[model samples]
Target chain A: MKRILARISYDGSGFKGYQKQPDARSVQQEMERALAKIHKETSWRSTSSGRTDAGVHALRQPVHFDTTLDIPEARWARALNSVLPKDIFVHECREVDSSFHARYDAVGKEYLYRMTCGEDYSVFKRHFEHQLREIPDRRLMQQAAGYMLGTHNFSSLSSPRTAVVDKVRTMYAIDVLKEGNSWTLRFVGSGFLYQMVRVMTGTLLEVGFRHRRPDTIPEMIAFEKRSAAGKTAPGEGLYLSQVFYEEAALQKHLKTIKKP
Target chain B: MKRILARISYDGSGFKGYQKQPDARSVQQEMERALAKIHKETSWRSTSSGRTDAGVHALRQPVHFDTTLDIPEARWARALNSVLPKDIFVHECREVDSSFHARYDAVGKEYLYRMTCGEDYSVFKRHFEHQLREIPDRRLMQQAAGYMLGTHNFSSLSSPRTAVVDKVRTMYAIDVLKEGNSWTLRFVGSGFLYQMVRVMTGTLLEVGFRHRRPDTIPEMIAFEKRSAAGKTAPGEGLYLSQVFYEEAALQKHLKTIKKP
Candidate 1:
């Protein structure tokens, strides 16, 4: 058996979520349906690095599947794209060893949360950004982020319904970038608990707005309860940017200052 | 009765077209429905600057309606916006005399046609651009635009289904601006017939690709037949950028050379 890995980008507004449910539309369902049509097999399945919530977009999500067909490796993307809807695109695909697991082999992941504090909401950008009525203090948000840069039990920053038994995770870096009226928060972590990124962003935004003190982050983390954190930011503004399987690639992904 | 004119922007991918039809979803239907709900009248109607085809977005389309409600001038936009769908946004509004009309009083119009030549199609841009596989020459397109300036009967550039008897229209300016891989064709004219801007863009592209000569534009217009021109460009890349009520504003819209 041969395993093939495909990197895809999706506009998630048209889907309910990335994971498969019994009654709702999903990206996994569409991927499996395209595979079934290609292989003429009804029980075909695929495994992804992680699942994104409803209305969350992705730039480079990877998935792997085993098949018995003799089609060329590069041609898999074109063949699958022919059957998939326009909302999803398969841009790259390659063959992988049978021992490679798409989910278990991941070493790091990156996420981007975009928030905009414009004079008014934009019609064209209603699908991809969190709109705020007032501007937040970038310095306060940066100060709050410094407390979350190391290993900790993130029980306060995750949903209680997450099925994981261990909530301890390591944060590699957090970058705050501001351009015009929009602010983008970049998170690099070993792994994320369910809804962790959104909760952290929500907490940091509160700190920026002066609703919470930046020094409160340590107590929020040590409380080890979900109620200690701020609200979970909406899924519309969250994006799964990349998944890394190697330490070298993860280190290379960090942003470096440029000399003009 | 008081007349109010509103400037709106919409993402047309969610609607069938801009005109009101019996069965299909339309921008007109949504606007009138929002008005009806706001005024408690089922017979509210509106008139627009012009009609756009299906999948054509608009940045600053204007519309007017008469109402007996006592809502303040500035608050009308907020009231209607409260009920309108997210895809359509009302950005500006003002009170006008009853003599001023939205459709018949228009003096000039500007439309933009955006096209991109990329190595592969982008998934995030499936709603707004015309994707091309090969790059077209910019100099050839500019040379062809020279034939389309000034007063002339643009019969070949309009659709045969246009109901207007007088097809003579004055062309003021045609600016072809290229930034990176994308080309923006801006058209400023006294007025346009049905599908005229799209057909003109399509013909210029054919000239850029060497399928037609630049000097052939005169003969194509003199032919007085729609078949004499090139293929009709799709509606996906077209945008109703603005409408002008005065000659001075129209002249100011022309492209001016910048001093670096």
Candidate 2:
């Protein structure tokens, strides 16, 4: 058996979410359906690096699956893209070791949130950005984002649906960039809880708008309550940009696996 | 009655064209419907800067209409946007002279054509760009574009739907800009005939791909037949970026009309 890894990108507007539900359309179901056509099997299963909510786009989503077919790794992307919908694209594909777990072996993740501050909404970019009438203070938002760095109990930054008890996570970086009328917030972290990025963005925007003080971020984190954070930003502005993993670990595992 | 001039932007994917058709949905139809709601009257007419083909987007499409309503010029945008669909926006609205015509008063126009050459097609930008597997030679395309500049009879570049005998037009500039995997061509000209920009882009792309010679552009113009030019590029990749007019001329005409 050969294990295949694929890097995918999708416009999440048409999908319910990344995960599969009985009646709803999902990214995973569409991918699995396409895979079934290629493998000629109905029982094939695949795993993603992580799941994204509905209306959340992805630039690079990693996934892995076990296959019995012996096709060239480069050709896999072309094959999958031919059958997949126009909104979903398989960018890269490669043969990987059986020990490489798409979810468990992942090191970090990066997410981006885009907001446009202008009175007139851009019809072209409406699907990709959250539009506001007033421009937020970038310096204040950046100061608030600084407090979110390092390790903390991010329970206040997650959704109420998050049932995980251990809410501690390390944030590597939080960057706020403003260009023209657009503001982009980038978050790099070990892992994220359900709707954590959206909540954090919402809290930062409140600080930018002077509704909350920047110094209050630490207290919010300490509260460890979902109610302490601001409202969750809309899903349309969120994007799963990248998934990070150690190259050394991948190389180590590759030595033990047979070539396809 | 006051003549109102407005700058509009729209995602043309939802529109059949800029002109009103019997059974098809058009940008003019939507704008007129919104105007009818504001005026509490069913019959309203509008004139656009020019007609854009089906699936052709616009960043700044100038339009004018006669209204008896006494609302402030600045408030017109806000009022229209509140009722217009999400895909269409009135960017700017102002009172204009009765002599100012949306079509006849225009001095020049600017069009943008986007092409992406890469193995992976971006799902988010798929609707706005034309994708190709092979990267075209930018220098070759630029060279061919140079031949298109200056006053020329563009009859060969126009579609058969163009019934006008006088096809002479002056091309101010044709800029070919390449960044990463995306190539953008900007055409600034006195005016364009039916499918003129698309045919010019297609011919330039043929030159870029080594399918045609750069020097053939002048020959194509000399032929004065539509069949002599290359294929017309897809409407989805084209954008009516800007329409240019003399501010002095507008001001001169404004002095003759009574202010609202």
Candidate 3:
């Protein structure tokens, strides 16, 4: 049995999300199906660092799977990409020890949210962007984003869809940068709850547009209730950027990965 | 009446083309309808530098429209963008002299054709690119492109759909640049015939892929017959980049540009 790590990218528009479902399309299902074709009935299970929602995109999503196929590591990428849909691609694939787990072994996750303060997006970029007609104040958005960094009880800023008993998460940093008619929010965190990024995006957008006070960040975090945060931003503008792992720990984890 | 020149961009995946067709959803038809809403009860004439086929995209397609409404020139861009579909946008609008014609008065035109030599494209960019499983040789393609530069009878390299009687035209230059998995063919010319760009791209692709030799270029030009060139490339990978005009000519066109 050999463990493998793959860096993937996908357009999640037609998917239910990253996880498998009984009757829906998903990144995991597609990846598994592609792997099955290459391995020829070999059982394979994939674990990802992030399970983004439908319509969200991924620039650098990392996943690990275990298989007993004898193919060389170099052939794995070409093999998988040959069958995967054009919207999903494996950028890099390599063999690793069996102990690596894509999700449990992650050290950090980074997400990016884009906001366009215009009526329309660049024709070529429409699928990856969400257009908002109202203009937002950049300074206020930046101020609000700054307060969002550090450890916080983010119960109020996370979606209620998931039952996360402990809502405390450490946000290493949050940066809101503006350029012309667009704004990008980069979130670096140890981990996140369900829809946490989108919820934070919405709150910051409200602050930028003057609908909420910049100081509302503290109250919202302290509230520890869903209603205290802003609305959920649209899924189209979100992207799962990177999944980081400690190299020393990763090597050990890869040894126990399962194979057919 | 005022004449205005607008720089527009569109994802042609949803439209029949840039021209207005009686029963088809066209970029022109949509823009006309949207503009008519602002200039109620007024019929306006809009013209583009050229028609881009369905599924083709544009980065700087120039258009001219005549109107009699009283809206400011600066507001025209935002106003039209608001009513346009998410895939199309009016990037800028400025009053042009009465004599300015988007097509006839242009001094130069730039077009770009993108092709990917990979199994899959970046999910966000799939719609804007054409995938070619067989990688083409760039050096050979560049040699063929070199033969295509300068004055020539392009009738042999154009599609039968072209409506022009004169086949002699000058192509200032053709630049083939490769970036990672994608190859971009950029053409600068005085003008292009109907389906000319698509056919040119096809012939170049054929040569690049070794289906034909670079020497075939001069032969095709000498043949001066439409059947001598390669197949027509798909519209999905083409873009009308920009239109250029002389300052004096632009001034004359601006005077006739309509308001609102």
Candidate 4:
């Protein structure tokens, strides 16, 4: 058996989400369907770096699957892309060791939220960005984001339905950049709970609008209640930009999997 | 009565074309529908700077319409945008002189064609660009484009179905710019014939690929036959970027229609 790791990118407009559901369309279901066609099997299971909500796009999503078929790693991307929907694409594929778990081996993640602070909405970028009528004070938002750059209990930022017991996570960085009439917020963290990034962005936007002071961010995080956070930003504006793993661990896995 | 001129933008994926047809969904039809709804009338007519083919997008398509309703110029954009579809946007609207014509008074036009010379196709930009596996020689393409920058009989570059008697036109400039894996071809001209820009781009691509020499461009133009030129590029990759008009002429028209 061979383990394959594939890097993917998807529009996410046509998908319900990344995880599979019984009836609704999903990225996972579509991927499994394509794999079934290639492997000539009824079903196949795969593991992803993480799950993204409906309408959330991905620039680079990693996934792993075990297969017995003999095919070159480079050919796998071409083979799968032929049968997959136009919205989903596989950019790279390579053989990996059996011990490399796509979810467990991940060390960090980066999420991006895009917004257009223009009075007139853009026709072409409507699907990719959230539009606001007035520009926000990005400097204030940046000050508020500084408070979120450390270990904290992110329960206030996560969805109330989150089932995880440990809500503590380390935030590596948060950057707010403005280009023309567009604002982009990037979040790098050890891990994010369900809807955590969206909630954090919404809270930062409130600070940018001067509705909340920058000093209140630490208070919100310490509250440890979902009600303490601001409204969740829309899913369409969020993207899973990248997934990070330890280079040394990955190299060791690759070395063990090489043919003697 | 008031004449209104609006700068419009649209994603052409949902539109058949810019011109109105009997049973097809065109951008003109959508604009007229929205205008009728605003005017509380059953029908309305509008004239655009020019017609764009089906699947050809427009970044700033200038259009004019006559109305008896008394609405402020600045409010027109807001009111019309409320009724227009999500894919169509009215960026700017203002009162113009009745003597102004959208198509007849235009001095020049600029069209943009985007191409991705990358192995992997972009999911988000699939509707906006043409993807090719091999990278083209941009320097060679630019050399060939220079031959097209002058007054010439463009019958060789236009569609055979074009009904215009005047085939001679002046090309102000043709620029081939490359950025990373993307290539953009900008065509500035006094006017373009049916499918002229696409045909020009195709011929340039042929030169870039070394299938045809750069010096052969002048010969192709002088051939005065549609078959002499290369194939027409796809409509989805084309965009009407801007339309130019003589400021003095527009000012004179505006002054004539001004209330005493």
Candidate 5:
């Protein structure tokens, strides 16, 4: 069997997240169907790094699948893209080690949330950004972010709707970059829980709004109650940016950003 | 009567261009319907800079309409956005003078044609870009562009299917910007013939491929025959960047993009 790794991006506005579920449209289901057509098999299993909810968009969602077909690595990418819907695409594909798994062998993941305080937005970008007409205080939000970083139990930082057992997670970095009225928050960590990043972002936004203090986040984390967190940020602004695996070589697969 | 100007953008894959035609799905028809809803009557008249063909996208397509309603300038932007389809959007809307017209009052227009020679594209951007795996020679294309700039009769550069009687047009600039494997051809002209920009891009692309010489363009222009030009570039990659008007002060009704 040969393993293939693919880096993918999608609008996600029309999908019920990344995972396949009955009675709903999903990127996974569409991808698996496309794969089955390429491999000409009925039982092809595919795995992704994690699940993203309905209406959430992804810039780079890594997935790996094993196949026995004697297809060239480049042909697989072309075939899958040809059969898949226009809204979803597989941009890059390459062969990897047989032991490499998209979810299990992953070391870390990165996410980005884009927020804008503009009174109006271009209809084209409405599906990708969260519009907030009222400007928020950045200084307060930054102070709150400082408290949320490092190792902590994020049970209070997630939604009550989530039912994950283990709540402890380490956040290596959380950087909030602001440019005029637009702000982009980036979070890099080992993994994320159900709606964890969205909830954390909402809590921080409340801090920016002066409804919560930056110093109060520590107590919220200690409470271990979901009610301590702020409202979950809209999924439209969330993006699963990158996934890292220890077994995979990063330099060869990463896209280079050329300076103008 | 109040006049409103709207700057718009769209993914035209699902649209039948920007005109209202009988029994065809057009962007103008959709906008007219939306306007009728606001006016509480079906009678509506609007004008656009020009019409874009099916599957042609736009970064900025200007249009103006007359209405008697007293809606604020910003509210028109928001209101139109709310009712517009997901693939189309109103970027800006402002009140203009009654004499303002989207087509007749135009002084200049700019367009862009993106051509890619990449191995493959991300599935997300496939709709917005044209893919051509082979890199064409840029020097030859640039040399040909120099000859095509300035005043000329564009009769040879248009489609035989067009009904327009006038063929003379003045081109202010034609530039080819190369970034990595993608070459984007930009044109600024006083006006363009039907499918003229696409044909010019296609012919210049042939020059880049060495199939045609840089000097052949002038002969084709002098010939004044539609068959003299190369094939029309695909509509998917064409964008109407901007429209300039002589009688209008652009900043007088600006709601966004602060003036210098």
Candidate 6:
């Protein structure tokens, strides 16, 4: 059997989440269903790089599965897309080493959180962007994000439901991009805890609102408590932009991404 | 009661069509439902510039209604938007002259049709753009469009179900914009028969595909038969971009619209 790694994209509006669950519509369930049809009587289990929450979109999610079918790389994408729903799409597929685990082999990840504030927010993007109740100060948000760079115990910025004890993670980059009334916060890290990106964004927004000071971020991270951070941003605004396997490929892939 | 004019926008994916039907969901039904709640005892009837077919979107569709309520122009949009679904939106509102009628007073209209050819089309735009099976020659398409400029009998370019006796209409502008793998065609005309824009786009695309010679366009217009032209493009790719009242406003408004 050959292991196939595929780059996928999906609109999360119609899905419950990325994970498969009985009686719930999900991206994984739909993908595996397509795979099952192509594999004849055999069942093919797929593995993803990460699990995104409901309403969270993905532009380039990587997934791997083993199959004995001798389909061409380009034909695999075409075949899979034909059976998959319009909301989910397979962009590219390639044969990979059997030892390459989609989750464990991932060296880094990148997430993008979109936000719109004030009265001029886009009506078209209501499902895709977080609409802030009040306009926040951009400069203040930028200063607060700077504190989140590098290695730190980000337990305060993760969900309390996260059971893993190792909270220390390296944040390689944090960028705050501003355009018109909308802004996007991009995060590149070695790995993120559950809801880490959302909580970090929410905390920085609180700083922008002047409810919390930029210097308070350090103490919040040091406290290692979930209560130390602000409210978590909505899942609809978050996106799993990329999953990096090779450390050298992170910067090269980032340059290709454009502003929303 | 004052006649209120509003510019509306909607994503047509969830809607059956623009007109009110007995059972199916429509944009007009949703708008009127919101208006009925605000009017209390009295019912306000709305009239649109044109009836768009199923799955057809609108960027700036002008609608007018007579209302007894004394709500401010700004508040009118806000009030309606609050009651409407996320797919439909009220962008701008104004209290127009009492004699103004949405359909009768309209002098001209603009329609935009989007298309993408070959394999590299955007996956996210499946619901919005027409994905052509084969790549078309753009230069040949442009040459065919030139024949469609100025006043012509467009009976061959509209649906056969059209009841209008006079099919002659003046075309002010016909622009074909190419960007990457996708292309957009914009049409500004005095008036269009039902499905005229979509049919025209299909005919031009057929020219681009080399299925029909560019010189045959004038003969198609001369024939004045529905079978003389190419097939009608799908409604999903069509948009009612603008409805013009004042003759001078057409050029001014056209300049403001950006490419898809």
Runs with alpha carbons beyond 4 Å of true place in candidate 4: A118-120, A247-260, B22-24, B247-260
Model 5, position A80, has a per-residue lDDT of: 82
lDDT of each: 0.89, 0.88, 0.83, 0.89, 0.82, 0.87
DockQ scores for all predicted structures: 0.73, 0.71, 0.54, 0.68, 0.41, 0.42
lDDT of 5 by residue, B1-260 (tens): 89999988887877888899888999998888888888889757778889998888877688899988999998997788777777788888988888888899888887888777755554445556677777888889989999988898888888878788878898877888888877788887888988888899889888988899998889988999988888788887788887878624433323132232
How high is the lDDT of residue A36 in model 6?
Answer: 95
> Over the stretch A19-134, how does candidate 3's per-residue lDDT look in tens digits?
89889999999999888788787545788886999889998688888887888888888888999998898888999878888888887777889878865556666667767878
Q: What would the TM-score be for candidate 2 when compared with the true structure? A: 0.89
TM-score for each predicted model, relative to the true structure: 0.96, 0.89, 0.78, 0.90, 0.85, 0.93
Ranking by TM-score: 1, 6, 4, 2, 5, 3
- Candidate 3 per-residue lDDT, tens place, B41-148, comes to 454578988888888888868899988887889999989988878778888899989899988888877788988886555666667887787888899998999999
lDDT tens string, model 4, B1-260?
99999999999977889999999999999999999999899999999999999889999799999999889898999899899999999998988889999999898788999999956788988878888889889999989999998899999999989679899998877888778988899887889999999999998889989999999988888889999888899887899997878855534543553323
Error of 6 at B3 (Å): 1.6
Native contact share for candidate 4 = 0.78
Candidates 1 and 6: which is better by lDDT?
1
Model 1 TM-score (B-chain only) = 0.96
Clashing pairs in 4: none
Off by over 4 Å in 1: A255-260, B255-260
Local error of candidate 6 at residue A155 (angstroms): 2.2
